[model samples]
Each structure stands twice: as structure tokens, then as C-alpha cells.
Target: MNRDNEKRVTPNLDENELMNLMVDGIRKDGFKNPIETTPAEQPENKKPVIREQNRTERISPTEYEEIFFKEVKSTARHGKSAYIDPVHHKKLTRIVQVIGDDNITIYAYLYNLLEHHFREFEELIKEIYEEKHKPLF
Candidate 1:
């Protein structure tokens, strides 16, 4: 035998041996990775380092309130109208019953609304085209 092949050899570790070695190291370290821990120091609240007036004009509380309330009212009215549309409300009720409370029903209703709008658009287009270019009748 050649000297290269005749030397005593150590057995290679199998998967289980490698896994056991890792588990043993982890157990000896109390199951936590060795990491440095440093306590955070509290930041001092000092005066502004650089004082500068805001370039943007700030709205007064009254103006802010008026704008906020107007937006809230407008959104509430729109939401009520959408929720109370008889056709949409009925379809939504049926969909909820069938689908068991899945929120995707809202998307389904939106898709149906879009489809209805598209049909209306097609009708309007047909009407306009017919008026502009009457059939050769």
C-alpha cells in the first residue's frame, strides 16, 4: 500500500453526529447565543441645538377643526349613500351570507359596481355614436 493510503484515518462525522455536537454546544450555553448586552443611557433633553422658525405657516386651531370636520362629514355622507344603495346592499348581504364574513366580498362588490359602470358607459357611447352618425336607414 502507498504511504498516502496507509496512514490511519479519523472517521468523518455523520449528519446525526454533527447535529448532536451543535445541540451539546447550545445546551452548555443555556440555549442562548453568546451576545453582548449593554444598558441604554437616557438622553438629556437639552435646548434646541439650532433654533429656526418653521417656513410653513401653521393653521389656527379653528381652521384645522373646520377642515377636519368638513372632511369627516363628507366622508360619512358618501359612505352612508354607498352602504344604503338598495341593489348594492342586497348583493352585499347575499355575498356575506354565502362567503361567511370574508372581507373579499367588498372587493367583489366593487368589481360588480365597476362592471355596471362599464355597461352604462357602453350604452352612453352607443347612444352618442348613433346620434352623431345616424344609420343609413
Candidate 2:
């Protein structure tokens, strides 16, 4: 065969030709037909697993009594006011009596009250001790 007279077979491929060749290679490599999936069929709406928060458990009657008496004893020892206010001690005592043996409720109530009072005290102290400076104009 004369080299110049023989028809030349050019194997250079375009992008689409290259892609078809790749697909053919993949089919030959045992991925003959990929399974078709629809957007709705896919798990797009799946929610991630999350843990639930632990709830606070109720306190026992003995614990409640212990806490109540301890507060009383500590107040007496510190010579602190027996109530949230001096004149309102009896009314406060009645309220405490009404809430007796309910440690969880008592604790929550006390925590809220203390938080409010502490914030008020902090504001008072800030106002009392706050620095005042005159502008040197």
C-alpha cells in the first residue's frame, strides 16, 4: 500500500464525541445503565436526628423541708431579714407556707425573685457609685 494514496483515518474527537466515548467506556466497565432518580423520589425533606432536652425533675418533700429549714437557719445565723421585706415578713411567711413541700416550684420562684432583686440591687449600686465627670470645655 502506498502511504500517500491510502485514505487516512483521523481519530481526533470533539467534546461531544469525547463524552460519548467516556459513556461507552463506563458502560463497558459494568455501569451499563445508571438508575434514574426523580427529585421528589429523593429524600430531600428528610429531617436530621436530634436529641430531646432533659426536663427538670420534681424535688422530694424531705429535700423541700431541708431547703426551707436551711434557709431559715442561714438567715438567723446571718442576722438577715427573715423575709424579702421586714414589715411583710408575716405575709411572706404565709406565702412560703402555702408553697411548702413543693421544692421545685419554690426553687423556681426563689430563683426568679432573686434574679429580679439582684438586678435591681446592681442598678441601685451602679447609680450610687457611678462616676460623674465635668467636661473641660
Candidate 3:
């Protein structure tokens, strides 16, 4: 049998048919390439993580109540406009209507939120702002 003279018979099966044949043969031989994990082999009680996934410390409802009714002490006021998401705006409006008296408008609610945020991150915010701040000579 001369190697050069012998014509190799190429199988006429399509790619999918060829793959199926190869896979069937491999499976029959008890050779698991990827090693698929069956449901029965896996732990039945395995649970996904359900802990507090908040990025910041979880604030109590009392804290929120305090912030919601906190009096604005700063006399310095600036005229500015804010574009809030429609859904969030609606929610805020509802909250203000429910929790607010004559003193707490949407403006006040947002200002208090900003004030709380600034107070919490005052040092970090100051540092970052100072780094980027330029004084006109």
C-alpha cells in the first residue's frame, strides 16, 4: 500500500452531520471534554447572595425622616434649574405631597438632599474641587 497512490475517501456528510457523528462517538467513549455539571450533581440548596448590596451605608427610615424635614439654615440662595428624570420627578412630587407641609417644596426636598450629600462627602468634594480650581489673577 503506497501512501502516495492511495486516494483518501472524504466523508460526504455536512458539517452538522459530521459534528454530530464525532460528538456521538466521543460521548459513547465516556470522554467528557467540557465536563457539563448536571442539576442532580449540583447542590440543591445553593443560594445566590442576598445580603445588603448597597454601595453606601444603609440609612434608617428615621434618618430619612430627619432629612426630609430638615430646616434650610443657609441665607445664601442661588437661582438654578434642574432637569430630573420624569419618573423620579413624579415620585418626588408624590413624596413631597405626602410628607411635606407648606415648608417643603420640591426645591426644598432637592436642596436638602444635596445638602446632606455635600455634608457627607464635604472633605472629599473639597479636595477634588481644590485640585481643579483655578484663580483669576
Candidate 4:
């Protein structure tokens, strides 16, 4: 058979075509390809099925308590948290700028200011307190 009349086939063929050649005992330049059983011939794999996440999962009571009360604890000891007007907030920020300490925080400046005006600040905070917590005499 003339090479020109015969159709050309490359060594790198598709997986199915290669399998078919192996079954047919065809080799390319003495390089034999291994025969792989068809996927249908193998048993179906029992893959672990994954379910969608429970979007409406409820938080546990302990988890809720931890998150809700974590920050609301004694502000006097931990530090007071106030939602002041933006203008006052900016003024407080300016005080830290004037102090010229790069490491100083707004809390330190605010605490220092409160300590300076303890009489006034004490009265203001006391007025908002639910009940006058008196120490046992």
C-alpha cells in the first residue's frame, strides 16, 4: 500500500479512540497503549452527597449572651463608650492632636478631660444612671 493512499493517524489520539486501538491490537511505532475499561464497565461510585447549608439556623442562647453582653459590661473600669454628636467627636479628636503624642488614644484624652472636670462629668453621668448605687455603710 502506497503511503500517499493510506490515511495519516497521529500518536496522540482521544481517550476513547486510544482505548479502541488497544482493543484492536494497533500500535504506533511499537509504542503500545494500555486498555482502560469503559466507565459503564465499572461499578457506579457511591459519592458522599452534600446538602445545602441551613440558612435559618438559630443561634444558641449562650452564644447570644456572650455577644450581646460582652461590650455592655462596666464602662467605668473598661472605659466609657458614648455616642456623642459628630461635632463633639471631632473636637475630642482635636484634643488628641494638640497633645502631640503620636501614641495617645482619644480614650486617654477624653478620660483626662473628664478627670479634669470630674465635678461636672460625675453629675452628668450620675443623672443618667438607673438607680443611685450606694455602697453598704
Candidate number achieving the greatest TM-score relative to the actual structure: 3
Per-prediction tally of clashes? 0, 0, 0, 0
Give the per-residue lDDT of model 1 (tens digit) for 1-137: 68878796977657765676675554546534446433343245522245445633776756533332221112232443344688967876776455434533444445454554577478776886888996678
Clashing pairs in 3: none
lDDT per prediction? 0.52, 0.52, 0.70, 0.56
Using lDDT, give the best candidate's number. Answer: 3
- What TM-score would candidate 2 get against the native? 0.26
Better of 3 and 4 by TM-score: 3
Q: Where's the lowest-lDDT run of ten residues in candidate 2?
A: 68-77
Write down the TM-score for model 3. Answer: 0.45
- Pick by TM-score: 1 or 3, better one: 3
* lDDT (10s digit) by residue, model 2, range 1-137: 68865677776657765676675564544533446656566575643334434422655766655544334213234444334565565654555667653333333445455654577478755775665544579
- List residue ranges in candidate 4 displaced over 4 A: 1-77, 119-137
lDDT of 4 by residue, 52-72 (tens): 366336667565333322322
RMSD to native for every prediction?
24.5, 28.7, 18.4, 26.6
lDDT of 4: 0.56
Deviation of model 3 at 126, angstroms: 1.6
User: Worst ten-residue run, lDDT, model 3?
Assistant: 47-56
